[model samples]
Target chain A: MEQSGDRVTLGLDEVFAIAKSVLVAAGLPERQAEPVARVITEGQRDECHSHGLFRLPGCVQTINHPRFNRAAVPVVENTTPAVTKVDAGFGYSLPALEAAMPLFVEKARTVGISVLAINNCFHFSALWPEIEMLTAKGLVAIAMTPSHSWVAPAGGSRGALGTNPIAFGWPRAGQDPYVFDFATSAIARGDISLHKMAGKPLQPGWAIDADGNPTTDAAAALDGAMLTFGGHKGSALSTMIELLAGPLIADMTSLESMDFDDGVKAAPAHGEILIAFDPAILGGGVRDNQASSERLFSAIVDQGARLPSVRRYEARARSLAHGVQIPRHLYDQVMSLPRAG
Target chain B: MEQSGDRVTLGLDEVFAIAKSVLVAAGLPERQAEPVARVITEGQRDECHSHGLFRLPGCVQTINHPRFNRAAVPVVENTTPAVTKVDAGFGYSLPALEAAMPLFVEKARTVGISVLAINNCFHFSALWPEIEMLTAKGLVAIAMTPSHSWVAPAGGSRGALGTNPIAFGWPRAGQDPYVFDFATSAIARGDISLHKMAGKPLQPGWAIDADGNPTTDAAAALDGAMLTFGGHKGSALSTMIELLAGPLIADMTSLESMDFDDGVKAAPAHGEILIAFDPAILGGGVRDNQASSERLFSAIVDQGARLPSVRRYEARARSLAHGVQIPRHLYDQVMSLPRAG
Candidate 1:
């Protein structure tokens, strides 16, 4: 393999190959490794850098831990026509989530809406991929996950909540579907790490130090707490996620569990909720729904309207057409990883 | 009526009476007056000043217009085992929303999840009252509405989208539960009005001028555009609401050719969607679901957790116990309205 400094720039195929090899070398079955690798690399290819190749090293490190059940498959704990709960059996979260997607889509199609809750699953990759997958099938979806404690309750001093994130997807007529995925926290944990590495101060109102005072210092903020997005409003939503994903799923929450370390493995536990509806069920079915939506959408545009995701969609289209440019630094970081089989 | 100097501190009962009288004098039926008065007054009693008694005069003014169908009741357009759509028939929104609540609750209890879509309604009062009612029944609820265009699309210089508020309620065990309601706009439209009334400049990033230039002057901001919460993310969510509420229910959108000044005369336009889910469906059964939610809620608290909405709940509790304290200036504004009934 050719290397640029300590990093390497590889095409999508090459990146997937590298990721698959690393996961297999870390004891994931060869068959399982490829799919997981594909998911991560696709995230990078889509320009979601925080969740893509940047996370490989950490994930590899996680897989090497004795607690990870490389061979385990999730088991269905309970399911109804409208809802399903899965026990991930302490295995990787991506495969489990992938496995649940069809079941969720199918159920929603049959009944207009469906929800899937997974417990005891390890880190799932970027939420947008799953939401995109669902929306492509002409359905609306919402997904949420709770992480280890990183955020504080509104107006409080210490960390008591996760940087919980929620993602939503909607299908529009005659345009790329609108996809929105965001963390409830003012800033993502990955951004904090980036700030730390660059020795940069965070923006005001982004975080609080250990004593609960708001701080711009990256290190102090990391030692302290992340603030919720939109103040108390965001905090309330984050807490709701905890209820849905934590106790609701029979999993340990950020507050109830120890830090996410090898020896202190909490239930590969997180929660995700999805809602999907068939527009066809409404008035004249999907076609009428589409026409009405288009009319309203076009009217808004006519009235100086701008649709959400229009910019990102345009950027993505341009990147796809002209080719994405990977920074030399990020390219090098990928090459530094130990070679797989 | 007794007035104190330039202000008045009417008791909650008196405030409700004044509101009811205004609606009645404006030609609303006496029977319909109580619900309208109750919704508006509850806002003040619950500390939501923006949507409380302050809106009474405007609502009364709207009611007096020949376009408002005061005698009309919301008609059920369609109903399924798990879904229903109501045509508000250009009636006052408060009565239409109130008429649909029990139906939504009944269906939710039967099917574990139910969706109710309301169309052709004017702006309803504060969403919290509807959601609070649902939570009190041990059901999770989400309510969203699309309004007149005021917010600009992300990266755009002009107004194109409505503030488009989304509200959620989660029923918890042994707690007041959590209620979250917020406009997608970075600052509410009322805030803009309040700033103009005070002759003060708005903060940067809060709004754009008529020409789409970011401005701090309240008047310019009002003439221009409002910003969305959380930048692109909030903008995306607002767009989704438009899709869900505007077109999804066969309602005429703000984007339609109808004049907003005569919105009350428009064919039952503008849509609202409400979703209710019984937690039991996910937790195996009703008891398990309730127990699980309660357990999760308590465990998080036990582990250095702070509940969301506790502050507001506390404020409300104190207000109820000791009575709400309205500022002298605000009290004066309410007393200035012409006497009715």
Candidate 2:
């Protein structure tokens, strides 16, 4: 690792090692700690700073919570021909999703489409990693999860919705997968926190004060409610996520998840819903479908429109070539975690 | 029927009859005309004017197209355990979806989730009707379709995407189903046309002129490109629809669909993809999930936020109590069509 004026640069190996050590030291068993560490490292490698080392303190806080299970073993259930359910036993969502991925891929190929439901887990990472995993296996993937209640419905005055995110991935032949993961909320909570840290106000329309009036103050918006991305359309998507990833899977809603925090607000414990589709089984040759998509991609590029993951991929190339750079303060905070026995 | 001022009020039966007569008169067979008419009537009954009687002229135009098959028969194929494909034989999508409905419900109930693909069909109505059909059968439904390439992708300067719409439905016991169908574009094409017809300008963010600059003139936007609803997020969704409903089903993307039009620009001929989910098979009782969703509905309502379908339901109740009202010009247009022998 090398330290500069205000940032530290570390090789990918050192990044993963430090994350894993911190997780393990905080009492997460190896099975659960590894996937979480890998996901965080990938975020850093891709320069998605919000989901990178900045998330370390929250992961440690959640791991140290009384309700968290240190040695959780995710149990997978084959509930139906097209559904695979994983009960994470109150552990991290990453390991549970990792445990059920093979089943997801198998069922998708056999049934043409399948659902993988993960319940009773704490989620604090971006969904692109999991989406890319399925795309890597030559399948299309979609994933969604509800977080703590911090956003308001489109026309609502108070916080009653999570900053729910939806992610999608499509396989590309000999190229990076077409992937996008986004919060239905107008702004991600991490960005808000970053703004608050920098003493900056938010852009207009991003949020409302506690009284439901529009406000640009980051602190006020955090204490109040964040708006959805596309007004009612985004709200509808968020509500759908709450229903599909929540009640349909027999798990906690955002409100219920928030209540479970009992004010501590450690990473929200909830559920996730992931779906996989095998292009070949849908009557199209997988390679042909990929080829067809290339045309659409070309059209977008020809018009000077960049794909959603383009920047991330560019950052990934840089990180692979010259390691990752992180703010010094964030590195110090992560390094402050106490070591385990 | 009763006439007052510039409007005419007709019972639901009359509404269906008029729509069916016009379709049949334009050469659609009874089997195809029935479902199409039913969907249009439902749109009127629910006061979704864009998809109601306003769509009749376009439907007739498409039905009379040279490529349309007047005696088309939809064929359903059980492609996979959880995937059902219906080839509409270049007919209307309604009948194709109708032919596959039973299989969709059965497979979803058995497999916990399923996909229904309708290909080689012309789609010209709202997807809410189909979503509501699945919701009525106690299933959660999501549907999407690509249209003519009249919208541009985010950061793109030309027309490369469709006003792709996505719809979702969730069942609610003894009440109207929770449903929403929205175009990924900033505005629906029909609405833009309506604005043009009314000699009104569009909202600032709704579209761009031919030169790739934002414009409020409805005519310029119609001749140029429409913007997506939520900028990049909505653009991603529109692209997803293009792939999922298009190449994934061996059907046409929006641009290809437009090419097939050859400048005539009739209703889009493409494919639709619908996915169904059964809560009971996913370890939650059907009623339990419905009851759980009720709380979310209540939360939104308690805070002055209205559910997406509330206004439609209200209009439906009023229409049922006192027949639908239509503008005189629209009624005259329908009345002018020649009757089939």
TM per prediction: 0.86, 0.98
Docking class of 2: medium
TM-score of chain B of each: 0.87, 0.96
Q: On residues B1-341, what C-alpha lDDT tens digit does candidate 1 reach at each position? A: 34556544556787788788777777778667788888877887777777677777677766765666788687774466557777766666667777777777776776567778876666657677888888999888888887777788777777667788888887867778767788888898889989999999898888999888899999999788898877766777777787777666656454541354455532223678888877656544222455545654554465455665556687678656756667677766666766565
In terms of TM-score, how similar is model 1 to the real structure?
Answer: 0.86
* Chain B TM for prediction 2: 0.96
For every model shown, the clashing-pair count is 9, 0
Give one digit per residue, the lDDT tens place, for model 2 in B234-340: 99989999989888787889988898888776888989999999988774532366666788889889999999988999999999999999999988887887756
lDDT of 1 at A150: 77
Model 2 agreement with the true structure over A41-119: per-residue lDDT tens digits? 9999999987888888889999988899987999998888799999899999999998998888899999899999998
Q: Could you give the DockQ of candidate 1?
A: 0.29
Which residue pairs show collisions in model 2? Answer: none
What is the DockQ for all candidates, taken in turn? Answer: 0.29, 0.62
Model 1: per-residue lDDT, tens digit, A1-341? 34555544456677788788777777787655766797777676676777677777777777765667788776764366666666666677767676777777776676666677776667647777778788889887778777877788777777777777787777765668767788888999879989999999899989999988999999999899999887766777787776666654446566543344434443234555657765555443322566666765665566565665465576556545544456677656666776666
Model 2: per-residue Cα lDDT at residue B65: 79
